[model samples]
Target chain A: MNETGRPQELPMSNPRADRVRDVAKLAGRPARLKRGRFLAEGPQAVREALVLHRERTAAGESGVVHEVFASESCLDRLPELAELADGVALRLANDDVLAAMADTVNPQGIVAVCSFVDVSLESVLDAGPRLIAVMCQVRDPGNAGTVLRAADAAGADAVVLTASSVDIYNPKAVRSTAGSLFHLPVVLGADIGELVAGCKERGIGILAADGYGTLNLDKLQDENAARRLGASAASSAYALEAPTAWLFGNEAQGLSDSELALADHRVAVPVYGSAESLNLGTAATVCLYASARSQQAS
Target chain B: MNETGRPQELPMSNPRADRVRDVAKLAGRPARLKRGRFLAEGPQAVREALVLHRERTAAGESGVVHEVFASESCLDRLPELAELADGVALRLANDDVLAAMADTVNPQGIVAVCSFVDVSLESVLDAGPRLIAVMCQVRDPGNAGTVLRAADAAGADAVVLTASSVDIYNPKAVRSTAGSLFHLPVVLGADIGELVAGCKERGIGILAADGYGTLNLDKLQDENAARRLGASAASSAYALEAPTAWLFGNEAQGLSDSELALADHRVAVPVYGSAESLNLGTAATVCLYASARSQQAS
Candidate 1:
């Protein structure tokens, strides 16, 4: 305890520390699912949470951060955490102990246990929805993170992670977000049928990206031309519209038949080479950015 | 050695296997560099070398691959490798020993020792002379690999790495390429000034991607509007039009002024919201794809 009389040390006996530790271990499948909590480690992820918190504050939204843990050495080395947790509880732990809690081989020397940002299908759709990314069964932690990062960068209003996708809480997935997980509404464990239904209820269009599809993205981004094309495509025997949700599927087995049936639009990114397919992450980034560009132009 | 008058196997005294094992141990900096050659392992990476070998064969070019090595298991698993080794010596070793030489946490049960593919600046520029990616001082293997993969998908002629960039042969880097390195020309250890001069010599364009640059990529990709609004800006006064190479710098320090000044064009991918900036890999993907799009329109 310093002059202020508040304990600056890690409360080894504290229930909260125990909880954070428990959550950190839950980075594996069982724990992530059991508690409806996922572990996010590293400085970039935690820093993004702080920024998200600030954005929530500015927007008058409830964005309460649960807990922040740091090595005293980290506290001395980096000021961002102290600044982010100005009024919150910041506990110092052994540097080695803190290092143990980090998922990365090279720890940034800080970690945080955060509550998932809550956003519902209704909220995402009702927010005057336009661009969104629906990630289905993307298994790679790095790939999931990359998609989320791309979604955030492309200004997708929300990212819906289907049940088959890698858990968003995995430390790698969190790190991959490049902190975009905090910038937008990331809805995880969403059901496919319900997601499609929600989008339909909210008048959001659904576009499925297939490398073999007949539609060209460049033509889709043109408002006047797209309006004409989308009119015939949607109104005729086949078509789609703007205010779309782009659906990306599994890395190996792509979008299932049932999932594909839900899309009103089928689009493909052209490839000039012999490679079987672009890695899922790259495909999604290309499509999402294409959609973003189209939306921006219109 | 099996009986039946067979030649003595001598416990499979595989020299290539021994070399792979030695290279794996060299990942520790002192070892890697102490010997001028570094280990490039895994089936995909080896396959990449084989593809390069094929390209060189077709082009009547030579000196692409120095050697190919595999565990008896990999050869059994991929029988096609046997056919690919026209005159190259094939040596088999124990699986466990090969595993020891493997860099990935899970060895693909295959490893190869090959001289790095040496491409003169003239060769790469002459190959397509339209698009290229220049990387400076990028340290992360995965980031480097992902960039290579992206550059490949974007159809860039080659990926040039400065001396400070992570070793292209790093196992993670090799894996990240996801077999793209096989299809693409990757020139490493070239001085940035020389790379710039080579691109200029070939009548190629140059664009340096910087976080602080004011150029909007969307405008750059919009050929019709850009042609009218910024014709000179996109051509003589700014853009390099003959062919083009987009330069990317290290993740942390970004491009130095000297490197940045060497480019004919500088552009930034616009960012909004509270996120700091895109990851190096993501930024490269976005920039490379943008260049591809710009070239397509042109």
Candidate 2:
């Protein structure tokens, strides 16, 4: 190991090495599932992964990051990553080798092979989560990641993707999360029906984010704020301060009839202008933030 | 014109034609600027363009749509497009011709050439805009469009892009807007210094969306909601309900010092979790919606 704790021996210079090809294969679903690992690329994601890895290891749990590959110049520029990866399998590689193992043309000169981070739904529900975000059949990787990142920003306890939803471990989805992927617990390939029943058994409210919903999210937020501030005693149909799971649906069709039927209440983020509706990510962010503020404020 | 009011006489079949090349060039800045026109590809954008065109022509103003090209299948599926383009020059074209002229791999079988729709800063100020979103050197086309769409959903009076920002008329930007581009006014090539001065002169509050800002957005919202609900009479440093202009910075580096100095206050969206920060679109949405709710509630 070098003085910086980054390995300086046998730098990976061959882009077509068998090891490099093996790492690159993780970009596909079959490879990722078979190996029980995924790639976390770029500085932000890799840094967060390393932090998580350190925390888990320090706590006597299995680490999340399996191995990390970084360019020498990357380590030189962001030395904290090298320090954070002290006991991990750290390898110095050329940019071409790094790129060959990455999904993006430029992985910002760093990438990490991370163990699957998703926990079982029971594990998340057992923690008594106050706020959760669920995506049902959300097809696009970008949309899926956006919702996950927004959920993290909103302080959501966990995120759940129903069966048939885009894979959170997809390279593009991981990039879109912008490191928030490592910030919170996630449940993937979950059955919406079973998840909803599990939440109900645990006394969690379910809200569906729908454009044509009967309830307005703003009114609920306003009511919650008023109630919290001692302004009014009026009761809202749904309380934003309660432990809740929000269901967000497909980008184009939104929540299907079956999906919408599972929710306790259908809520719409008010659109005060001519826009037909907010995009899935925008709507989901608004809903999550509203719930977060109400629960936190109270 | 046929019975459906579409120009079915001469179907555009040759993708190699000079006219097709000219239309295709609208995807680039030089061609767009030279012709003072841009492409609105796909069903949603073209339909919105036609709606705006009809409204303008009915009011004795010049139409926005110059020409529209569509495949027969697209018009057949969406007959409203035919009715909306009654007074416009609409030509039926084959999918190959349409694809050749479009920037996207799939134009969804329709495209429109529309005049530049940006208005002057003075015009926006004259309209007494209560809410404005200004992008300063934000280079991503998708980010620009997301902000625009969010602003529309929030009922902002206008959106402004300062010098060096991405061109909102870029094809990708237009597609990202999802037809919200036609729902509100936009100003382009704005100088931040002069624009701030103009907004201040019009009694509009200037708020910069900064991560390091001293003000917390949630506190401001809570205070505003409390005051509006007669729960608290406490005053905040900045009134979110007042006529306000929000400045969003570049995706990577954020606002320049000069740009940030122009704002009356730098307000940061409250991060409730471990996320380093929200993405440009998410932050912008939260800010705009907060302002919209505050202003509208009062």
For model 1, residues A1-298, the per-residue Cα lDDT tens digits are 4533233655433324665468457567687567555545667777777667777767997664566666666666667567876655566666555655667755666677666674787777778767889988778888888888888877888999888688777888888887787888878888888988888888778888877666766455433223432332332322223577989888777787777888886777665343446677788877877767666665
**lDDT digits (tens) for residues B1-298 of candidate 1:** 1222222243244436656557566455566556544455777667667777777878987745555556665766776765565555555656666666666655666666665564676677667668888899889988888888888877777889988788877767777787776777778888888888877877777788988876767666654335433333344244323367889989888889998889776788765334567778777877877766556655
> Model 1 segments beyond 4 Å from truth?
A1-26, A29-43, A54-63, A71-80, A218-241, A272-276, B1-44, B58-60, B63-80, B91-98, B105-109, B125-128, B223-242, B272-274
* Model 1 chain A worst lDDT window (10 residues): A231-240
Instruction: Flag clash pairs in model 2.
Output: none
lDDT of each: 0.70, 0.94
State residue B39's C-alpha deviation in candidate 2, in Å: 0.8
Candidate 1, backbone clash total = 5
Candidate 2 structure lDDT: 0.94
The TM-score values for the models, in the order shown, are 0.83, 0.98
Model 1, CA-based lDDT: 0.70
